[model samples]
Target: MLKHAPSSAWFRSALPVLVAWFSLSAGACGLYSLPPLEEQKARILSDQITLRALTAQAFLEAWGEPTYSHSEPMQFFPVASGNYIPRFRVPLGESPPGWDDSIVSEQALFLGYADRGELLGFLEKRLIYREHLPAEQIHAIAAQWKREELFKTRLEAPPARPPSP
Candidate 1:
């Protein structure tokens, strides 16, 4: 009969338990779990748009151009309304009609900006990032947009089809 060394015996006895313990710990910590398939889908669908580190080009590419753009007076002090320019008590509305006035611009479906041209954030009900989003859901949205575009094109074209030769 053959016998395992003491260290081998310890390893054989401890390995399975160690694996089980690690698995349980990870699962308990929310690092791993097999939730229902539908629940997984729901979780992905509910993930909100994260705007940090996103750029204007990326936003445009994802949403395929904003519906519109709105511009507002860029305040020297965006947080506080009272105008005080660097130790000078510059009262609000002192600047003549269009003097010293700057504009901050943004695009819609609810995206925000850091400055005139810098994109800062986003809001809900817009096209979510397909790569960041679940494949099934994003693909579905893309298909829906394609259908809408085709419908629009058909509406703009003449009704009769050109005769096929």
Candidate 2:
């Protein structure tokens, strides 16, 4: 007696099940796993060289839009002044007589990403500093942002009219 081979229809039905089983097993083996968000954030932050090189646009693409942003004005004296004097002063005859001790204002942008527990500072569109806060601090910052947003909305809303009699 001759044994009959499995029909094409049988193979077709089994193919999907086989594929799903393999997919699930691969996932269970961690082959498809991704690092935790916190770990990823830590890794990204640890790369200071890359972080410092990132421009504001690149940072926005990598970290997404910040929850809140603010501009800070920074002032600095370009020339030596006060108690801090230069050890070797420039020859008075060689250079201009008076020192140009003008206060220069720099525009810095502070981006706060509460969800990622990060605060990034950018000067002239270039990243200057980054801070990663703990979960508790992140939560507090998120709460403060929410409160500020609510207050801003309330202030911007039109005054309520008295109900008609």
Candidate 3:
């Protein structure tokens, strides 16, 4: 009569082979390292043609991470005014130009890929704009944001104590 092994013994004997197979398969499937960033960018650009609408999560998955991300409040002028004014314009009186007493603002997220020379803007987690800018322009935009952030930080910081003479 042939003798049968216990379940525990069979499991113990097969464990090492199973582990080796899983490890080898994982490595071959690229679980150990990420693909090149340039390849990811190319894929994103190509995929975007068919995927006109992309969510923030989808963007992160495809682009990995942005070089810089900035969130700013966006103000819209009433369409009935028949004219549109830039946001930078100072309000002549208490309210902004083309803006009524009730002001509406929406938060927008801007993602910059300096290396890829791409700028993407998202509104409410949905991509609203994409542009292929020159690297210099991308750098300039990043520098401008840095300056603004520094200025904001200084303004919020406590006043420095004057040194005694």
Candidate 4:
């Protein structure tokens, strides 16, 4: 039998519990890293996937024909409504439009992905945004384009706090 080093004794002794813990956590991990919606859709359409794997046809069959079909290749769409937006992780909230804030508008990000030739997935969400554009329409549009181009951006989200006494 192989000898267990003292430092690694904890690991060996803990292996059974660790295995049990992992098995318990397996369910949560199932939904964590799904393939982006675009790729899954592409596979489905390409026939690498079939109706059984995805309920595409079943859904249509049950519900009747789809409302709309898309023609463009490798494109994604996000449709949303209302005043609440996603990516509003910052505590300060958004600043005036046309100025950089802790975040970008959900509309802009959604549109950007659709326009960028790919989308992570489709989401319907409420978005809140400033009403007035701080810059002229054309300039503002250009700035938004730049923001999309320079995608390495972040939004500040309020830290989760413990319930108050």
Candidate 5:
């Protein structure tokens, strides 16, 4: 007995058109990109990260720990609002319509300061120079902190060796 071929004439035509639609739809969403570490610095520095503006605790709470990405202040979504829209001005520019709706979650890479504000580092996007330090660096920092916990006071001048007569 010969098996009948399934009716795919409609499917064949719809598939390519559907694929094209999807491609166009994706392009509308904008290209997906994660910025490089160097660029990350530039990006954050462009935003500005300062010691006074952001504390270690603010970063820790925002991120998980003070990694290269934690030095800067990150505005995460689901609750990312720009500085509480003042009581007198019309919401314009950065606070555009659905500004909060656009973002998902933002994790920042740590970078130096710009002027006085908190710098929001770039998302490392480079293929070759995706600068991610080894886990040991993070581990070593933690280990050093643990050792410091044992310290109570400064060492007393290392026994003061006498000079030769």
Candidate 6:
């Protein structure tokens, strides 16, 4: 014959409920992380990535195709177009060419880089935020980038033609 300790009896009774609660909580929090785009860019720059060597195929293999792909007319040089200027987390200086200059110092985070349909490099400028971004938030930011690009594309026009040369 065996006797249960009072505490042991209590723990046994509570174990299932606690386990269930923990399982639900963990699932609710989600189990995914997005790579920190800013940090990755820094690493690439620090490594002195040879942009010319990178190709669209290799880039796609590494990072996966961007959630969105689009181009914008070069504001300073209107004759130039067809470059795949990827969307960014933070807009670079004078980007969108006439937007307010506030927060222009924070460098843009390019999700992809290609020109004339060839990958030259990805990511445009350095980050202002030096702190380590939580990995989990990266997915969210990536999703946000997709959303922003889709919205912009739907709402904006193709780069305007240079005034009839």
Could you say which candidate leads in lDDT? 3
lDDT of each: 0.36, 0.54, 0.59, 0.33, 0.36, 0.38
Once all C-alphas are superposed, what RMSD does model 3 give against the true structure? 17.5
lDDT, residue 59, candidate 1: 51
lDDT of 4 at 139: 46
lDDT of 4 by residue, 58-128 (tens): 22333334322221111121113222223321225433233322322222222221221211112221112
Specify the highest-TM-score model's number: 3
List, residue by residue over 55-156, the lDDT tens digit for candidate 1. Answer: 344455444453333222122211122111210112555642223344222222323222222222222222211122334443454454456546756554
Global lDDT for candidate 3? 0.59
Q: What TM-score would every model get versus the actual structure?
A: 0.21, 0.37, 0.47, 0.22, 0.23, 0.26
lDDT of 2 by residue, 10-61 (tens): 9999999999999856642335534444544454566532333455665565
| Each model's total of backbone clashes | 0, 0, 0, 8, 10, 1
Candidate 4 Cα deviation (angstroms), residue 129: 40
lDDT of 2 at 163: 100
In angstroms, give how far residue 165 of model 5 lies from its true place.
42
Once fitted onto the true fold, the runs of candidate 3 whose alpha carbons sit more than 4 angstroms away are 1-45, 49-52, 76-104, 153-165
Residue pairs of candidate 3 with colliding backbone atoms: none
Residue pairs with backbone atoms closer than 3 Å in model 1 (clashes) = none
lDDT of 5 at 114: 22
Error of 2 at 112 (Å): 1.1
Q: What is the alpha-carbon lDDT of model 1 when measured against the actual structure?
A: 0.36
Query: Distance (Å) between predicted and true CA of 86, model 2?
Result: 25
Question: Of models 1 and 4, which has the larger lDDT?
Answer: 1
Candidate 5 local lDDT, residue 19: 91
